[model samples]
Target: MTGSPWYRDGRMRYGVGIEDTFIPQERIGHRKLDEYELTQHYARWEADLELVAESGAEFLRWGIPWYLVEPAPGRFDWSWTDRVAAKMQELGLRCIVDLMHYGTPLWLENSFLNAGYPERVAAYGRAVAERYRHVWTDFTPLNEPVVNAEWCGLTGSWPPYLVGDDGFVTVMMQLARGMVRTQQEIAAANPAAVFVHVDAGFRYEGETSPVPRAFLDERRFVGLDLITGRVQTSSVLGEWLASHGVTAAELQWFRDNAVKPDVIGVNYYPGFTTARIEDGVMTPVRSDAAGLRDLVELYSARYGGVLAITETSLVGTPEEKIAWLRDSTAELTALRDEGHDIVGYTWFPFFTLVDWLYRYDQKQPDEWFREFGLVDLVRGADQGLERVRNSAFPAFRELAIRDR
Candidate 1:
């Protein structure tokens, strides 16, 4: 785990992740939402790392809040992160550090659309790599670029708000550029670094839909395609992007400086990963193991590299959660048996997290809490939110130990 890359270790790795999104901006009347604060992770980070190690997980996908770490243009405060990184290494847990989750520093004027975003984010990536190259080697430049663009561009819920397909394309271009530069910076610092490009695995269904299934399917891979330089003029999404205002030179820029992921981490939740779009309205369709298998196969066929279920879980009763753990792992095992390069499976967010809706509504964290982890969060009057281990904890531990 220390010298060689874990994905190259010839084992099906098992890991857990903490929900580490830090959107620090409040638009309209909405309040900012930081998962670490809501879950008290900052105060109890040591205990949280211990809990992850205790669960028999070898890896942890966590993020550093850029807004807090870099309050000024050229200054950084790594005191808190230095401790967390040290503790993670001490616990023998391999860290796949998430460099960007959603938000940027308040000092960054226009968020993702800012002309200097790519360079600024790359600078942060370089600093992180230089600081913790020994403690961890895996890095995710940004988590869920599609979701980032959706919230910030398509829906106009986040910073530098721009709506419609044009906005999404604009934001995606900036993200892809930043991601490429971030990967380059991290590699310059640590030549042996591994990049796990993580994104939400979106699946759209419905024969009589407003958006063509073919287009949506192709669109799902647009973010990944852009980074890897797969969106050429002859590609399916190439013309669509051009029609939206992307020029030939902009498309060629990605081709000239493409950065392919060592492992494509697709975050899939059976409860809401797949959807049915009808007459322009989209509805979440609850899917099961079969749905997961389809997504794994799709990504594998497209990227043809090491693939991992970077995030997946059910927000349901203990029984339902346990069932998903059994079913999903079984399907992945079958895929591995059939010669798929599926290297890892991660039950994301080791504990509960505040729902994203909490940011737009004035409600207590407990009210908007989601039970998607092996551990549950309970509100304590004196101690804030307490981490309580539920039945799924032991179940997931058993799977991790048995699988690894």
Candidate 2:
């Protein structure tokens, strides 16, 4: 807290996730599998890492499909992560591996949401953290506890989707518990493993339906509170949590245990803004993008931890994206100046993703597929990579090199 970043910061570091930048998700249901397309996808990812390395960013966040790593119990093949991990090192950029992005590796049957899923995931996390002890240093054990719980558990939109405030608490508990223990297990083995806890950022109640807003606003974070070990006799949130799936006993466990994060990696997405409830539905309230900075500050205050925007992107022209980036950076700079331990910043995806709005329900290429990329997918191939020397690129460069 005395110095800048608390850990790492040179001109307020800049980085982004390599999702839309590289790689593609394998189809879940009856999606056709042409081996040729899949192989091509992997090859493109290798080149994409090279792009990430050359982007003048300090780090690149990538992930491995859990299904591939642990096909079943006791079986581990790291080929899925090996290529990316090795490539990241070869490029001389740090790797922040995303262990859990969406759900379980499918073979786990979405196990992290299960009762004992934490035990299983922790087992794997330890083995994995140890195995990659030499190369991968950072780990995002799970992504977006509140969002994942709501989407997968409350809405029943995702796999193993269940609907209820209680179900939300249970699933979120399994993830937070499993992820923390996994990091601990790794620390036990390697003694050098450090975890950067990643959380999604946004403040959205519902629009029309009282059902969504009711629980989302109040009961959404029972597990997060528990894992952070913040349960107390006088906690207003704690008592309400007890009435839901999270009970007094669970609160005790979280308060007594739960290792606080080394760096709380926040995935600051605009999508966290208002949804479901709209003008005529629930209320017309909407959280402005500028207000997002306030939310980040609030989280840092609530928990004595370092903060970083691990993800952010928008569907707009390159210039518009730059404006968004500039504004967000200014906000981050203010937060940093305000004495918050803000050490890292990211633009997210560096490229646009396909079918995300579809929820994997449809494979159609919507208008969004056009170009949300910092460097268009064809930047390297078509325009000698100079194609990307856009307005936003220089702002980041000026920042990284500025004498602040």
Give the runs in model 2 whose Cα sits over 4 Å from its true position: 1-11, 20-41, 205-223, 271-289, 359-362, 365-370, 378-398, 401-404
Candidate 1, overall lDDT?
A: 0.90
**What does candidate 1's lDDT look like per residue over 136-171, in tens digits?**
799999999999998988888888788989999999
Each candidate's number of clashing pairs is: 0, 7
232-318: candidate 2 lDDT, tens digit per residue? 745766665566756677667766777767787766555435455654243324445666676677677778667778887765677
Q: Which pairs in model 2 have colliding backbones?
A: 67-105, 207-277, 207-278, 207-282, 208-277, 208-281, 208-282
Model 1: CA > 4 A from native: 1-4
